[model samples]
Target: MTNFFDQFMSPTYLGVPLMALALTLPWVLYPTPSSRWLNNRLLTLQAWFINRFTQQLLLPLNTGGHKWAVMFTSLMLFLLTINLMGLLPYTFTPTTQLSLNMGLAVPLWLATVIIGMRNQPTIALGHLLPEGTPPLLVPILIIIETISLFIRPLALGVRLTANLTAGHLLIQLIATAVFVLMSTMPTVAIITATVLFLLTLLEVAVAMIQAYVFVLLLSLYLQENV
Candidate 1:
């Protein structure tokens, strides 16, 4: 209400933690399967989508990596839910906050690196130095690789935050222009509204894609360690 940035800030009511509520709200939207032999169309479709997504996501992973299925699935659904829900009117998007995104990225990324180090320290540490490097460049290459490794989490959080924030800002700006020009420039207002609609659709696709990419990247990190 105060400014455009206000919309992206974590919402609060009185003293309640609305961000937690938003995070959990997506679970309520999903339906639970019944014990009966037959399933409803919604349940069937949901199951099918999740199944196919999981299969595809894990395709490149080893059997050892299969242990992460539940985590990966839950995370994917959580992210996908919050992202889509955030697109709705009068709702807050938790993923757009760099703090929240980094909270997720750091832990998951650390887990992958830890797994690699524990299971195969030789190979894990080896990532910091590529194979067959010239004797003179080993230290420089190690430093570069180490920096790159640490940058992964920062990149993940920033990427998600920046994408969602930019999309939201663009939509808000266009919608504002549409309102401001409606009386004096009816034709232009209509054109702006149309652009807003198309942009909204693109943002929706972006929401889905970003969620998948976040999980996909995590899976890839796990793959290296496994």
Candidate 2:
């Protein structure tokens, strides 16, 4: 029997070639931007979503942080597209890979920390030791806070990976059950297939939400720094 987990593994052609096609597929599907009096519905809807999301995300941030508007918006869209695409038949989710997730999380998280340290060193270090820390417990609290700070990126990566992996595994299990029962118990199989369809819908929501949460948390982190 094929291992259900095997689907999560990264596949390659000719020695693990970069999944360039999968990465670029979403961009290719997007309607091109046009300069005209009026635009198509798809382009208009895309513009509205981008505008709304950018406004909401930057609302809490200061004017200086507004510089990141483009980066954050692009990141959100990229993650959302990649995640939704993964749900298609025979497609692989690159976000399910810890390496890829960490590659995203660590640099962004580190950049926030760097900005905090460079721009507002006092306030940033102040986060390490809370106000009115007891004299005797200061060392312990500082060490704990430092550890927590470092753990943020790991948490980000693991949360995305675990959620995607769990949802996909559950869908696969239910699907396999449906297939197995079809030959002998057509009625039960039909019911199972219905449940599977519902689960797939739920997974679609999950994929979108996880991508949002990932970007949201990064924004919060950026807010702290800038």
Candidate 3:
């Protein structure tokens, strides 16, 4: 049987890497802002969207955290673009790979933790143990909190990877069923095809939301530290 999971593999052309091309494709999709007085529809829409998204993302952060405005917004747009692109037929979704997600998650998360440690070491270390804890459970709570702290990045990466992976797998399974049932069961195949169309729409929404959620959670972590 063909492995359903093979869809997630990075595409290659003559043994050369195409993952880099897939990863960079999102940047080219955006229309560059021109120096003219009037703006095109695409540029106007892009600017408006970025402005609104930036405002919402930074609403919870303090002034200090505002420094991350550019990085966070850019990250959101990149993820959003790549995700939607993946929904297209014969395209690879880089975010579906755990390595890419973790690579993004760990460093960003570590930066937040480092900011906390550098700016206010006392408060950062105090996060391990809560105020007014009973003496007996103090050590246990410390251990538990420490474990939880370390697992944040893992949680972030796994959440993104699993969501996209499951969606893509369901899409493939249903698509395969539609093809298989077409000749033998025309009526059922039609129904399956309709279901596939609906699922595709849902996956598009999932793509956008998961990207936002990934960035949102990072912002929340930043809020705590800053």
Best by lDDT: 3
For residue 72, give model 3's deviation from the true position in Å: 0.5
Query: All predictions: root-mean-square deviation over Cα?
Result: 1.0, 1.3, 1.1
| lDDT of candidate 3 over 1-226, digit per residue (tens) | 2899999988889999798999988898888999999998989998999999999999989999999999999999999999999999888999999999999999999999999999988989999999999999999999999999999999999999999999999999999999999999999999999999999999999999999999999999999888
Tell me how candidate 1 scores on lDDT: 0.93
lDDT of each: 0.93, 0.90, 0.95
Tens-place lDDT per residue, model 2, 127-187, is 9999998899999999999999999999999999999999999999999999999999999
> What TM-score goes with each of the models?
0.97, 0.95, 0.97
Backbone clash total for model 3 is 0
The candidate 1 region of ten consecutive residues with least summed lDDT is: 1-10
The TM-score of candidate 1 is 0.97
Q: In candidate 1, what are the lDDT values of residues 1-226, reduced to their tens digit? A: 6698989977789978698888778889899988988899999998899899889999999999999988999899999889988899998999999999999999999999999999999999988988899999999999999999999999999999999999999999999999999999999999999999999999999999999999999999999999
Predictions ranked by lDDT, top down? 3, 1, 2
Report the C-alpha displacement of residue 191, candidate 2, in angstroms: 2.1
Error of 2 at 79 (Å): 0.9
Residue 196 in model 3: lDDT: 98
